[model samples]
Target: MTSGGRRAVTVLSGFLGSGKTTLLRRYLAGHGAGVAVIINEFGAIGVDHHLVRMVEEQSVLLQGGCVCCTRREDLVRTLRDLLDQENSGKLPPISQVVIETSGIADPVPVLFTLGTDPVLQHQFAPAAVVVTLDALNAAAQIERQPEVRKQIIAADWVVVTKTDLAPFEAVSRCRMRVRQLNPTARITVSRLGDGSDALAPTRGAVRGLPPEAPAAPHSEVQSTALGFNAPLDWPAFGVWLGMLLQARGPDVLRIKGLLDIGDAGPVVMNVAQHVVHPPEHLAAWPADADGSYLVFITRGIDPARIADSLETFQRAGGRADLSVRELA
Candidate 1:
């Protein structure tokens, strides 16, 4: 539980055959105590919940629909009921909640539901989004499926599973593809569902950008890394981001960075589609980060246009000399 007494919620998402259940089952093996799980399956019958039930007894199943669309209200009511049970001694106290989404589901709507709900917003706080990527089929799946790309983009930590079955080169390429789609996610390799470390509650920090990789074949998703030479006006940047998301939320897939808002330390920013999480202010900057930098994962948008708009916004905020450069 967080200091605010809210239970931490982790959203597990992946495409079909991405090893989501395998990784989740492994995670629940050792951390089942004080943890509750909600499994969402698209079909009329739920099978994943049964697999998870082997390790955890406090599990709920939502069937016949995807959590992102038809099952959102069900998700709300289930969470409330869990709270009621814990309060009344019907179930053990839950410190963490894991929501495993179906293969075709988009995670942004789940996050939106949690943030916007009246009772849920106060009782639950987002911990992290862990996504599973199949090492052998990720390249083809990412190229053909928009759902796979969205899952990767919304992930905070992406676990590349089935590494033992895939060749070394295939795993390398899979990691590169995930980096292309979501530059901020921490990528790790796992064999036989041993990537439980990915579920650790720590957020993946901005460890400077990796070497640039060629654009994925037949994909419009591109990541642009921008560095600001000077501190930005936080209010002005907020306005610009708000208007940008309002206009092009779908095109702008993800935005994550550490910003120097003329404070003693940097302010951390994370966004998925149109949902902007509350900015975290640190007492000091991390040793690795030299200055403020933002990586934007976008589709069908020119990187130059984004840089120009940010520069224009900063200038209007009285920082005319604040130069924004695209990192190589």
Candidate 2:
């Protein structure tokens, strides 16, 4: 929720066949209560919303143009309509809103619309950005499409789908590539019969993740996840992070991690380009999870260099070895 007590908004975006609708279906089935959903599809006929079993009355569809492109005003108007309806008691009070963008759409433009639109900004706050990546085709898709990079870079959480259909090596490479593009996004592999929690709105933190300039050099994106058993020095880490962002904002796409900040059980920090969302403290470490798990996604930047830099900044003396044989 925003400081004004407005409903939070979550944008679910990904490339075509990335299992976005599938994830949205599961999310609606489990957590649709008091939630308003906006679905956008590129094609003229919109069928994704029909797949959702409930909340037909609360669902709005924007078809033809992608929400981030030609139909942007429609999106703004639709959001306003939803707000007016709730205020007039025409529709049930919305505790939250989830927008599923057309597969081809870039989430950043839509994010700009929400953040800059005076009316919607006051009534709703951007809560999270969830992106789905197809394990079977992500490697090729990333190579062929620049939109994929922007989608991953703007993501708060990335769900890797269709792993069962792809070879283990292919899946590993795909996941690694995704991490490199958006270091801060929490990535989880999706398996058949996976639960709805994967798509549920992530609580805490409200900040925007803007895309990098279009002129970034052509290079393969890379990701590395590091684990630490001890608490991180927040002050030292802050200084290092500020310097890193200032120096290499374009090369660094995203950084998302759960940190053991001493007395606090765990705190989550998300950084995208130059923006750093306020860290959120979790109630406790996730089940069976120990210490901190930090993920970094970068283009033309080596994970080893980043690890070494952190060691230097924190004055930790020795460098920690990161086993890159598998995804974290």
Candidate 3:
């Protein structure tokens, strides 16, 4: 664990043949000092763990199930065991734990297990969800596989892999699709797992929001960017968001924004489905940030409706002059 006594966990997820292993192996090559890995495979035998073991000795394998489903308890147990071993001096002190999930897994359940488990919550803190997308097959896979879309929507950073083999147009299309699915996720390109830096722990880095992409005709997921012309009332916004998430949690895939609440800096908000990360208060706004804005990734929800709802809620909260406009 770090000096704070909590081990930072990064969930690595991607569809089959998306080069998840390559990225993990590359990352461990340089930063495997105090890292432990938990590899979950869908079948009876686990093979990825052995490959990763070449670089890092502290590795555990969970076989026969997906971490998101049947292996959730297994994951919790593995984590608890790691902690126990560290405490008892059976294993070295682990500062970071990397959970490389099966290709078909949905990462949301893994996060839920970590956040809700009474014992694990205090020992582990989520660092990031890094996903890999194959440039050659991303568009087709995203269109055909629901899991791929879910993984993309849930990612904190997405790496488009196999760019060297795929044509330039295919890579561009894949990036566009990812942007449409998760506007706030940082997207990077990689050839032979060169984009391993995306796995590095973020330290309140200011990520400039990507320009909104046109909605894909074949995909149900869409992103909406909303800008507030004035500072917001924090308490009122909380109430509005709480009610909204309670009512339509599943439909809301991701919510990320920087809110100006009449403070010297902005409040950073990140939400993944029902999981609401604690809002971070920055000392000052980034130089590039012009004003408060929010990006919402939703399915089967109208962007205009969301804008109207927020405007109504803010108006009711005494911000009659505050205008909520959909950013172009």
Candidate 4:
């Protein structure tokens, strides 16, 4: 959020019921700097954004799945607006941008955006994706959800939360599981510790900072485009998607992908718990590709495990087959 200099975008993502909102509220209040937040919620209702008790006009609320593939344009637009405000002296000198992606969000694409988008690249820097892992339910969720895997794969920092609710042994196990999925991310364990605990009060003027790295090509990061590849059968995909949902919705961080509704092209994949949205055929595949594919960003979940469960999805369909993977 360094004015004039490029900025940084930090993402906070985790599984459902992991107490992410509570931690985020604490961070915002105690951060003591000009920070804007981007909230990505699962439902059209937009409950999470309202739940965050902050008063910032520049904040953007995106009601959908992971912001990476689902509403990337929204991110680009929001950054531009924030930059404009900062330039005009209408807003405080900003320091950082933190995003609270949907519980099922895979932070990769959103993080990838900083390195990819042309305009955004000039004005912003890519901070590490900070993820929270629920100590209580992480094990089961990892076993069942592909979204969980994506969350972990994309994380540069993994925070283990809700240790107070878990037994001592449970906390230890949670840490072990987090390591299996991400060997490189820096991990911070917080049971009752919230954002307020992390940030100390500060009184000072913030200076603008330039981006850490040069903007790379956007296509290199966003090569994985699923739903645009081919037409997907609504009923068939539904059945397969449902089975995965039933087996792992609790583990789901946030589900966003492309689907084939019918003759209409953009049968979208927008998921939030038990309620999965039917396909809303858009004009065409977002970038005009003919084959439709599915990609997932998960935490503590394995792509192979997810694929094996949803295999009942081929058109000929003796027994369907499907798989979910984490994008680098």
In candidate 3, list every pair of residues with a backbone clash. 1-94
Task: Provide the overall lDDT of each model, using Cα atoms, as 2-decimal numbers.
Answer: 0.79, 0.67, 0.79, 0.55
User: Per-residue CA lDDT of candidate 2, range 1-328, in tens?
Assistant: 4445878788888899888777776777677777777877633333344222121112123454233322257568788888888789978778778888878776755655666577876777678888889998898898889888888888877888887788889878876776556655667888752534655555523222222222333367766666554566778778888889878877776677777767646777776544565566766776645457667777788777887677666665232332221123
> Please, what are the lDDT tens digits per residue for candidate 4 over residues 1-328?
4324656566778888776666776676566367777776643333233223222222233455433333356577777777788789977776677777777765555644455567887777554467778888988887788787667655556778888888999888777666555433456678575633322212110101111111231111111222222344566666777777667654554344545544645554434333343334555555533444455434455555655444436444442223333323
Winning model by TM-score: 1
Show model 1 residue runs off by greater than 4 Å. 42-71, 205-218
- lDDT for model 1 comes to 0.79
* Model 3 stretches with alpha carbons more than 4 Å out: 1-5, 42-71, 204-211, 215-219
Give lDDT for model 2. Answer: 0.67
Whole-model lDDT for model 4 versus the true structure? 0.55
Clashes of each: 0, 9, 1, 34
TM-score of every prediction relative to native: 0.87, 0.66, 0.86, 0.52
Query: Which residue pairs collide in model 1, if any?
Result: none
* Native-to-model Cα distance after best TM-score fit, residue 211 in candidate 1, in Å: 7.8
- Candidate 1 lDDT, tens digit per residue, 1-328? 8547889888889998788877777777777778787877533433333223212112222354233322367678788888998899988788888888888888877787788788998999887888999999998999889899889989989999999999999999998888878878888999988988676555553454432534562267878888888999998998999999878876888898888999998888888887887777877888877788888889999888999999999999889899898977
The CA lDDT at 71 in model 3 is 28
